[model samples]
Target chain A: MTLFIQQLFDGLALGGVYCLAAIGLTLIFGVLRIPNLAHGTLYMLGAYVTYFFLVTVGVPYVAAIGLAAVVLAVIGVLLERIVFHPLRNAPHTHHMIAAVGAMFFFQAVAQAIWGADFRRMESPISGSVTILGAQISWQRIVIVVTAVIVLGLLTWFIKRSIHGQTIEAIEQDRTGSSLVGISPSRVSMLTFGLAAALATVAAGLVAPINLLAPTMGDALSLKVFAIIILGGLGSLPGAIVGGFTLALAEVMTSTYVSAAAGEGIAFVVIVLVLAIRPTGLFARAVQR
Target chain B: MLTVRGLSAGYDAVDVLHAVDITARAGELTVVLGANGSGKTTMFRTISGIVRPSAGSIDFDGRQLPDLSADSIVKAGLAHCPEGRHLFAKMPVEKNLMLGGYVRRRNRGRVRELLEHVYELFPILHDKRHQPAGTLSGGQQQMAAIGRSLMSDPSLLILDEPSMGLAPLVTAQVLDAVAQINRDGIGVLLAEQNAQTALRIGHHGFVLAEGRVVLSGTASELLDHPDVREAYLGV
Candidate 1:
């Protein structure tokens, strides 16, 4: 039972990272209606930014994470204004191609800047605590706490704040939102920037535990896509629930079964879920 | 307070409106009556800056509004309540209404005041203020849509098919609310397929057929026209 509890906490720590990435992806899909394929590249870039800030700039760990978030947010806003805004009314195919192109471009850029090698950051929190007779890394604790706080704040913002409600309105009906004076374009830019910042934060949090490489984000991106599919696309709460569930399942499977089979677990669960609720766990009945 | 001259717009490869001329003055309820595909909604879209005009110009409140964005247009005091009650489905009714005042700078207090006013106009919405807009009845959604538009505190309020998909009694309530809104000093530009009800409340009426205004007159005059009776009023 203690082992089970320990495994659950470990699963939750990993889930926190996935939740941040998935939330970003879901938010971008919700407001922009564009599946941002480059989102993972942004995540990798964030890790690299943190690395540079810590190693070269000699910034403190917390400040490095903060700087990475702000930097990525600026990059996101720039991408929105330069790339996404012009393609607002373009065909879905065009956006898909553009996003894929952006992903490749960012990958190339990261490889050029950071090189094609795997780099891992030193953990800011190197200590551990005893929880239920299990050793728990302080970093893991930080991850879980940060995820809950960020997600909780995000939920409150979306549910209670004015700008967040406007974004929600735009997501539901773009044309209708425009009629009510909510600028879809402006909202799109904000959502994209926000998604990018979230990816950065996720990368900063997980870089200590995970190796960072230019291509590392590709697998993470796929996992996020799976999470989005499992959670309804455009549902923020769904992303959180889906991320944690997928993470726990993967961890349990890897522990009980072969490690090789653990990777396919998320897909198996996704397929089963899709068979039952094709619209995903949190899909609203009304189609956009 | 609104004028359109030689305005033309269409979705890719299909022209909807061709050189349409429309005008709405202050303190008047101007109704645009048409059949489906007659470009009534298209006209509203053009005026509200959703559908950009292919040619000519739209002058709202004495300013040429060709390249302005939709929110900017709304900020300029023109509010559009679109055809469908596109209330944010997952959001609460109060939040949806607050979004309508997104561009208003100093009218937050006024927004609260208007909320009470709107609640009085459609008492049903007040009861459902905390509920998700998607949970509201069709008529209630319609009222929320209109109330949302009014939240912007626009001098010119444009509504597209405000009476669509409702029982006659519900339609009467909506139209009555619209008339009440107009009586409170805002100019209204209403597009509707229900000609008899629209014409009954309008100060001036324009009949649109295949994009252009086929006829225009005082509401009573248009109501009495033999061609209007045959084609639109069904009397």
Candidate 2:
């Protein structure tokens, strides 16, 4: 029972992390309709930014996270301006090629700047507390709490704010959005920057536990893609539900079976579930 | 308030609009009548700056419009209510209407006034304000679409095929709303396939065929013309 409770916390914390990271990708996909392969790189960049701020600049963890988010947002704006803007009208194939190229470019740049090292950052709050015979880390709890708050705020923003309303409107009908005076280009720029900033905040929270490496984002992005697909592409609630579901499934596979099974099980479940419910778990139904 | 002189534009190599010339004056409802594929929509697109003119010019209130972006042209007091009644189907009727006021986002007071104005224009929309746009009837959806365009408080509105797919009665209600909007002092450049009804409400009309203006005359002249009667009105 204790082992089960411990693993549940672990799964929940991991799910929270996944939810944060997957949201950036999902929002970019949902609003912009771009398969943002570079999201993974932004995640890696965010982790690195956090590392640089925490270790090199020697700021407090909270301040470091804040600084890293801002830096990543600026980087995101630059990324949109320099790369995505020019290729905005390219064919889908070109978009795919460009994103793959961007991933490698960021990886190479990181390698040159930081070197090929698998580095780890120490959590500000360490050690574990026992409750109901299960040991839980303070950091993990923070992850879960922060995820809920962030997602809740995001939901609120989209529901109540004018800018979020514009995004929602555009997602519904692009031509209609234009008539309402919403500039798709400007919205895209802001969304990319915001998604990048969100990625950095998620990275800042999770990097201490997962550690950091240039190659980290590749597998993480694949996992997030599975999450987005499982949740229903472009659906916010779907992403959250999918993230938790994927994390629990992986954690259960690791606990009951083998670690190897955990890694490959997401793909297996995706293939099976997608085969049955083609449009995803929460696909937007066509209205009359 | 709007002028197009020898405007030629198209998608890539194929020209969809050929040297189109038209003018829409303030306080008048100008109708551009055409069958499907007659470049009426392409003309609207050019006027709203969705597409650039390959030749000639689009002047709105003495400012060049062709080179400006769609949003800029919208900011310059032109609004387009596109065909097919493209409402945000899943969103509330009020949100769909509020999104129309996106350009004037900074002005909450004006937006509130506009909201009240639109609600008054289409009282049904206010009654169904909280419902998702998809749940509205065909007539109500058309009213919401028109109400949305009015939220921007545009000087000249380019309405594209406002009567598409609606029943004759619903079309009449929608056209009546357009005339009411014009009476409120906005210039209306309406495109329609329903020639007789459109001419009845319009001050003047232009006919487009195969991307060229085939006929141009006052409302009564267009209704009485032999070619327009044979080709469009079926009289």
Best by TM-score: 2
Residue-level lDDT tens digits of model 2 in B1-235? 8888998999997899999899898779999988899999988988887777799898999999977888888889999988887899999999999998989989999999999999998999989999999999888988899889888879998899888889998888888988898888999999988899889989988999999998999999999999999998887
- True contacts recovered per prediction: 0.88, 0.82
TM-score for chain B of each model, two decimals: 0.97, 0.97
lDDT against the true structure, per candidate, is 0.87, 0.88
True lDDT of residue A66, candidate 1: 87
Per-residue accuracy of model 1 over A264-283 as CA lDDT, tens digit each: 88889888888998888999
- Candidate 1 scores an fnat of 0.88
Stretch of 10 with least lDDT, candidate 1 chain A = A279-288
Q: Judged by DockQ cut-offs, is candidate 1 incorrect, acceptable, medium or high?
A: high
TM-scores, each model vs. reference: 0.96, 0.97
lDDT score, candidate 1, position A124: 77
lDDT of 1: 0.87
